[model samples]
Target: MHKIKRDDLVKVIAGKDRNKQGKVLNIDAKNNKVTVEGVNMITKHVKPSAGNQQGGIVQKEAAFDISNVMLVVNGTATRVGFEVKDGKKVRVAKATGKVID
Candidate 1:
């Protein structure tokens, strides 16, 4: 399993949006990138298309290097750890040593 999953609360630890927290929207495991809501906003100019009647400059979230984000646990950013519990691997918060369910 990946350390960061969809809907997980994460905080950008690097780049222009450093320290900004947002929910994880998508994960690109092959590229090691993740898209977070309200982070890495980029404007794109689009021509009018059949699907989109009014296509102009639109703002959207862009994927960032997963290494640049840290998972948020208990309202704080923490490193992820793994341990076996009940014969199954489970995620743990390094900072608090608590199981992340």
Candidate 2:
């Protein structure tokens, strides 16, 4: 299972945005990357198109490697670990004693 999912709060553990917390916007499982809202912003210049009438420099979030982020759980960012409880799979937040369903 993917540790990061849409709407999941996460903290950037590495890169220029380290320590920044944001919600997960998208995930590219095949590439092992995720786009966190307001993190890793990049500028892209686009040519004017019929659909985008005023295509120009646009600032947007870029995907970062999933390994560089830690999921925020119970008010703290922590490493996620999995275990079986009552024959059901579960993930735990190492920083706090909480189960991530």
Candidate 3:
């Protein structure tokens, strides 16, 4: 399993959003990018369509390099590490050495 997954809280470690924190909205492992809520905000210009009655400029979260974020556990920003417990691999928070689900 990947260290970072959906709904995970993460802190931006680099780029213009440095120090910002948000939940993981999506993950593109193949492209090595992740979309975080309220991070990497971008504007999209769209025309009115059946799906969007008043389509106009909209704000959305954009994907950024996964390496730019660190998983947050218990209000602490920590690196994730994999460890085997009871023959099952689990995520461990480096700062507290606590299991993350």
Candidate 4:
């Protein structure tokens, strides 16, 4: 399983959005990238289409390298670690040593 997953709260540790925190909207595991809500926003100009008659410049979140972000645990950014719990491997927060589920 990936250390970061969809709907996870993450903090951008690198790039233009450094230090900014947002919820993960999607994860492109194959590309090692993630799209976070309200982060790495980009503008796309779209022509009018049947789906969107008023298509125009739209601001949306762009995917960023997964390495650029860290999981937020207990309100702080922290590295993830794996541990054996109840005979199962589980994620843990390095900063607080708490189970991350």
RMSD of each: 0.6, 1.4, 0.7, 0.7
Instruction: List where candidate 3 sits over 4 angstroms from the true fold.
Output: none
Give every collision pair in model 3: none
lDDT by candidate, in order shown = 0.96, 0.91, 0.96, 0.94
Better of 1 and 4 by TM-score: 1
Per-residue CA lDDT of model 1 for 28-78, tens digit only, reads 999999999999999999999999989999999999899999999999999
List, residue by residue over 21-95, the lDDT tens digit for candidate 2: 999999999999999999999999989999899999999999989999999987688888888899987888877
Model 1 residue runs over 4 Å out of place are none
| Candidate 4 lDDT, 1-101, residue by residue in tens | 78998999999999998999999999998999899999999999999999999999999999989999999998999999999999999999999999999
Q: What's the TM for model 1?
A: 0.97
Worst 10 residues of 3 by lDDT: 71-80
**Candidate 1: residue 96 lDDT (0-100):** 98
Which pairs in model 2 have colliding backbones? none
Clashes of each: 0, 0, 0, 0
* Candidate 2 weakest lDDT stretch, 10 residues: 89-98
By lDDT, the better pick of 1 and 4 is 1
- TM-score pick, better of 2 and 3: 3
Candidate 2 Cα misplacement greater than 4 A, ranges:
none
